[model samples]
Target: MDHKAAKRRKLTDKSLPNVILQNPDFAEDSQMYQSLLEMERKLDWTITRKRMEIQDTLSRNPSTTRTLRIFVSHTVSGQSWQAGTESDNLTHSETGENIPAWQLKIEGRLLELPQRGKDKGPPRKFSTFIKRMMVEFDRDTNVYPENNIVEWPRATGHHNPPLDGFTVRRTGDVPTHIRIVMYLDHYPEQYRLNPDLSSVLGIKEESLLGVVQALWNYIKIQGLQDKADRRLVRSDERLRAIFGVETIPFQKLPEYVKRLLSPPDPILLHYSFDPSLPVVEPERPTAWDVEIKMEDAALKNRMGVMLHTNKETSVALAKMDEEIALLAQSLHNSHLKRTFLQSFADDPAKFIQTWLESQSRDLESVLGAGASEGLTLRQEELRRSEFFRLPWVEEAVSVQEGLRLASKGM
Candidate 1:
């Protein structure tokens, strides 16, 4: 209901794929480019975390009794070997060598660990079976909502006692290995196989098991039982298991090179002036022109007298005109820059707003025909766009604060 909350939800939702697809030119500007880069980086993080989890799991079963182990030659040779050496007790089992940062060993041939077919989750009957269990969940007595689907089938043979324990379905451990859909917070279509993958996999009874798409879809619809904090606590109760949150001390380079470290958020790039440090200001372009115009008659007369000849006066006039034009253009440029900064405090956010606004404008233009009011309304709407709605807060913080934020969905 609130403007800010609505904006936040709209921007973060992954289900808005249609919205993303509709605007092919979503982020063509400098700001949008930066936003894309930052979004890519975030997705990279999700990928990195997944890879690390897989690596850790694989690391446990040295010879791969459980899951297959496929070693990347470079990862093992360089860091794994060196890392194995430092901590004598942490030596490799077979080689008995100390593990360095990430060193590994060479072999005659690359050993590929074969993937075991997913353990079929024992089939269970639908909700109709649950009705026979005589489990009475009378919603009139409680706040719990009633199940609307008349065809809702009870999960039969779900006797495995989650009675004392909680069911933990990890995004990683899911059988179909679905990827996280950006913005939508939903599974990709690949995992949502048509007419139920059960039919295609030749799985009779169409019972959702072994990371069934149906279960995932249900979980998404019902939402996860655990809160964010609950998830971390349950998943990694032992903090000592792995070292995470790499801490790199902030080492400032000459201000000029700071450009290389651009704001992690693309939007931040839109509003920053030439770096505050004088050395970092970009070199002046040869194309820049300077012009000065004399508004006073006396000033014009003095220039005429000084020049003496008409030819000289004409030449001076032309130069003055050029100089004046340049100065005005530079001023306008400054204003535009200021406007951009004031709007979003970053290029990416501004770019997104501009794009959305542009689309709205285009639509208004088509609908309004020759009417000018639509254009005016569009201009007003642009002024009140998300660019001005959301504030760009700084993410950088002290180590403790950073860790706290990271833990608390920073």
Candidate 2:
């Protein structure tokens, strides 16, 4: 019999503590149980490792796993612009079908080769490396209701820099990018990066094309260039076309947003001490102010409805009451997206044209003027349909009154 069985036979009438004291063999049995538990735990660890490997295989990975996309347009005074106002005004362009992103089709064939007992099959065919899907960025740098354009001090300094997005990725037989899940990029500190080991890790590696664009965006709003003498890069491109530690080249845009071609420090995340510290604290307005806000909302709602149904007006005032109600509902929720539809009620042609789905000849007209003068292309997006013109409302109201007069004439 085992140690536990022998000890149990001798402990018939003894209390638990007394049993352990008199029968020292019982203590040995306890140790044996602990040893057995350790072995089981080790077994579990082995099983876990194998399960993870199986799961890794179960998830069919694509050859090209990841892709970086950029949305770029022109902005003159980026930082001075209000974030809340910009969020409201930001819009997407329309295409023939008017979808947010237009998908591209690639001629790729399925690779199903090596039949049961036969030779290998043909390789997958691909016309292009990766498919391009267009995302629109429609800012109201165009004709609209006269809201003052917030301008910052011009880059009157030495350098006028432009930004560029430079992407470094592995080439494949098929032109598709594969995203690494565990992420091997040497630059994980900046979470968006996919560390490529083909080069050095945690060092100056390939510049993330997406990051270059985002960096440009951040720089446009929060530039590092001294506000004065910043135009030197633009004044004489031959002499000084670069800025900062990385020879980020200057272009003809709002920012001297330079692209770091080489690898640098591992982009680590900014670990904050107090996220709760209010950067822009909320102010509690008085009771009278609340009443004014409500009245404004009501008036804006009425105006919006009238504007939305009237294509004759330049503004968007569709179903103003309903639109306001929707806006109110959206406001009731606390979660914030990067942009909101409420602000674009003035004009959205800027966004619509960029994401163009309509097969209209006017698209060229809209786009051509945009490149030069920031014309109809970047008009603020109206949250409502085109029927919201002022003339439409006047006509509708007049038509109803005219019908009543006709009945009186009868």
Candidate 3:
């Protein structure tokens, strides 16, 4: 009875906390948890910093849209014949002596719409809003649109400079009507596809994004993707002719497709200028309507509201994240304590003996003491055929083989 009482006292003296505190693996795991928590905090701070930077940039450059109007006018100005010695013999009866010169004027303006409930009047027009305008003529003309056309910000005028108008002297051999091409800022440019591309896409003109999407669809339908590598495309006969290659990389499709695209054909407009009529008629200037992509003010306002972060909400979120991290750490510590106590409660003496043996083995390994002897003993035990014949060994091998086969199948 005395011996049994001494054994019980010895087991009771070895507490669960002492055993856990001495474990090297548990200490290493705790340090790793601390490092992970620190990394998470740094990651959260980086995300918040980036978000704030984006918000600041968005606030500085708020997007807005404006309406642009293109105006064109045609008028005829008569030039009287000067008293010259060369044409003195020519009879005044002939109409060739006095010829009328026709002039075509092209100008543009930006219109500002009134506020919803504040102003009730016609849209205000401004000439300074036009950043750049390019006008191209169908045939050769005397006057050309100026290069790098820019309007004065403070200039007050009915028309923008450099693109006011053009005058033509000879009209006998020239075509009756002409085609004018205009490109405006803040507008989506359209492209016309070549015959081969058009045949494949079934579209003559479309936006660049639309063309790319259509090409992607065609590739999907034709199954032109390479079997071995998805990034490469096996071009069909039609695509081969268009791209000039049997196989093409998917990324280079856009560069090759751009070669097959051209600007859309110019629109034709006819004008009849009468010298007898007044220069400024009631319906003198002809206007052509064009569609422009504008920034949505309502959508922008919504985005602004979303981007406007509340200081209180941000503080609350940060506090919540910190609290959650603390709770997670507390939970992890509680779990470790619970596992230690449960093992001790199952069999106190056995748990204490096993824990002390494990710690001694770890200490010996760390100090490089008696490691060769332990390694030799383990090798001798493993070398015996009886070790492989154990029931648990077969079960472990079966489980490992099953996991490997499952991974390969996946």
Candidate 4:
């Protein structure tokens, strides 16, 4: 198959759990496919019906009604561009280094009711405006590609492109900005209740629901409707603090609720180089590291699924051995990080010395084994050996020992 065809197939393939992938028998299980198909059909029908109902409502009353909603999505592009690859894609022209890019999409809609004239208290004409924007970003080395944004149905299409007035802008060097956007886009628990709001209502701030959803839930729970009219909300102590009045027209509640939200604090991106400023190292692994960890996890899961499939099979047993070895190495690295790295955080010099010593010890063992067999270590062997005595190692060791002694005396 051609590269493009293969890539398309890989992209379109249904992502099965590690178990199903490891066990092809399960992948082709007719019963499983049928069940999934049936569930998908039912969900589609239910969603289609609900959407139609919403459209009907909007069409019936466009003048005074509107839906205030925002949706975010992310997509990963495997394509990369080298510097000076202007013909291929927009990229840096200097170093010719490959630049990685991904896309983020944000969509929002607003419905406005305008006052026509003195005779008309409020405009009867409704204006519904929908906008969507897609932004491309250089994915941070620590960002996971699996966090790719999936398409959702909007209007008559799935995975719709950016709408009118959409534009792309580059951000500061920090990749966390992109990471944050992706996180906010796909966060599963979106609607956690705010503490201040919860206190006013005398309820615990529960699930991670958005402010709008949380407020709606609070209103429903309180049952604080106007005595004479159900269309109005009668203010209690909490509602009074919220609405600043004893009553709020049901239609205006949304407006008031929105007012309570404080805008998020701005993130600092640009900074002038200052030699006086202390250098701060990254606190955690980058997206690239995270992607590798995820791959390792998937491999482990697949291995387990294979083992469970048919433990007697020679192929499965051999795969299990290989997976076990890989897992062991991963565990060793994790252990070292948790052990020495955390302990020497405050003393980086000591950390470096200790790490070098550890490497030296391992190398010594390898060299000793080679010598025991009457084999002379070559230049390549010496270079690769951690314990191969070097001038820099001696100097670092001396400095580390002196520092340790000085600290003890002090």
Candidate 5:
């Protein structure tokens, strides 16, 4: 009895927390209970390690794991440009598609593949690399009338896919349970503005333009360009409330905006894995594997499309070349004929022929005797005129005068 009691004490001592071993019925199966507890603890640890690995994979490949939010920027008729205006007359020449005067601001990070000998994955600094990209109005929102058909941008007919969707929670601060969760988005502060700044800017109480583009637009519309230099912006009484000074350089605008408008409470998203929920790997393939397969299929389709387009383009080009060749040949023949005809254009034979045709009737009507008399009178008149100007005629006249003087002397 003493030995058995000692064994029981040893077993109870080895059991953890003393809570399980204290039970009257548990004493019989204490070892089994201890083994089960050990297994449960080990399973929890393994699950936690798996969760960490999954999160790391997600941050590295957000496209496959995370669904990015597509921010929609609307331009209502009154708020933005009206239809049929100069600004609304934009069109893309390449696609022959009209450009939407109002556009959506789809903000996303460009995940550039790391260069050789560098970190070989997406960038970690989300805010610095976040870019506001413009997209079609119809893509992210359905605010436009159903009848209005928005054309897709150029080179997007084949490759453009819909944006992924994910659970979003907008909160004031980054919540706890950071081990399992990862932030896929970082939103700008969104809070109410100072009453003085709002009143001076002439914007509604609800409007939030405190930070960047929107505030800049207001400054531009107010014609606040400094007289001395355009780069220096001299503010009016309204803007003075925000800037705290009469003037500020355009570059320093963001600094003043930060000062004037209170930044909004942070918007946090909870992406943590639920410990209570079972860790069920989907029966469907992993996102990476699925993406790889889709990419390969897409590449093949694109190549086929390109080949077909090139063939059609080649045929069209050949037809155009044939037409051009025909036109050139006809032009060359015409030029040769024109040269041949122009060579004899100034020939003496042609001139004589033309003159004879014009004077044929008048030639037969002339009087012969009158014509001969006219010809003789014309010859005599020509000889008389030649006598005064000719050197030989002057010499002969001088010789005759000398002879007359000699006769008088004799």
Candidate 6:
């Protein structure tokens, strides 16, 4: 077949590189360069997918908030509080004798209020917002009380097994007041935006990341991005009134947004517990519902597993990349060899003449005689076909022919 027909057939062939290399046209460096570009595009797509997965995992529940009902109640021995049932006949651990004790029951549960939206399923039995609860007891006496700080670790049944209730017992006089502190895990502090900023953001209180994301959404919806430079934002009238500027840089958006935020209002609860009154009467435990942000443990754990890189996998990938690079280099060298042989195979006479001219130029440049009189004389001799029919050529041919004949006879 003609070279052009063979080249067209090779281009349309649906076969591996090894099979395609059987055709001369497929062995061009241009084909190899195109293959490399395709490989790079695939690699870029893979990396982009991985990055998107990470971003989706991180932003899954950026500001997950829940209402937790904190119940605090006080009761003496032999009396039951509304918090939960407790053993009144508790004996001292060492003495093994019945002792008068004052019990403070501190419990937390997930509250499903009608005002708040309905949950997808039954509310969780416990609060996941609280990592642990710290209860401090202060007495009127000068002596420091033992077990002053009672820690309740399992505040939520989401990840950990649920506990019935957390109780603090004191053998001596009952204190008039107690302090309860809740510690949270993976919870970002919320801020209350000023009136001007809140009007633009549409939310009075939000986490810093949430606020920034909302502002970005607003900018995108309004199409305030500068056409000439995307890094600069063209402030609309509302934004201008809020930021007090005509334009804002994308990077400085967070800084300006932060200035309009103040600390969120603290939750305060006041309850007067009387031990003498019955639990069924007006002396029941006081419960306060407080909304707080918390991380989704299940989603976070899944994301963590996805993001975690195995050392063995990384090593294997690195080895594979090295092998690919070596193979690509080998393929490139093979392509050069194939092109060289194909050129000679297509037209032997012309290939030889072209190759000789290239070699003569290289030799002249290497010998530093390209512009000398000797190079001009050599070029003049090379232009004639009879230059190879000189006396030296005849003598060399005779010597080679004698050597071959003598070897065959021997």
Clashes of each: 38, 70, 0, 15, 1, 0
List the lowest-lDDT window of 10 residues for candidate 6: 7-16
The sequence of per-residue lDDT tens digits that candidate 4 reaches over residues 18-116 is: 433464554465466548546746765665565565556444332222233333343333233222455656545475323444334444433322542
TM-score-wise, the better of 3 and 5 is 3
Task: List runs of model 4 lying over 4 Å from the truth.
Answer: 1-195, 198-210, 266-410
lDDT (10s digit) by residue, model 2, range 364-399: 456555443443443443324364465755664565
Segments of candidate 6 deviating more than 4 angstroms: 1-44, 55-63, 77-104, 109-186, 279-289, 307-410
User: Each prediction's TM-score against the native?
Assistant: 0.16, 0.16, 0.41, 0.23, 0.27, 0.45
User: Residues 134-178, candidate 3, lDDT per residue (tens digit)?
Assistant: 333333345432321222233345564534333334322233344
Regions more than 4 Å wrong, model 3: 1-69, 73-179, 185-190, 206-210, 267-269, 278-281, 292-410
* Stretches of candidate 2 exceeding 4 Å from the true structure: 1-27, 30-33, 49-122, 126-410
Task: Tell me the TM-score of model 6.
Answer: 0.45
Q: What residue pairs clash in candidate 5, if any at all? A: 171-268
Scanning candidate 2 in windows of ten residues, the lowest lDDT window is 286-295
Top-TM-score structure, candidate number: 6
The lDDT for every candidate, in the order shown, is 0.32, 0.31, 0.57, 0.44, 0.42, 0.66
When 1 and 6 are scored with TM-score, the better candidate is 6
lDDT of 1: 0.32
Which 10 residues in a row give candidate 5 its minimum summed lDDT?
285-294
What does candidate 1 score in Cα RMSD to the true structure? Answer: 41.4
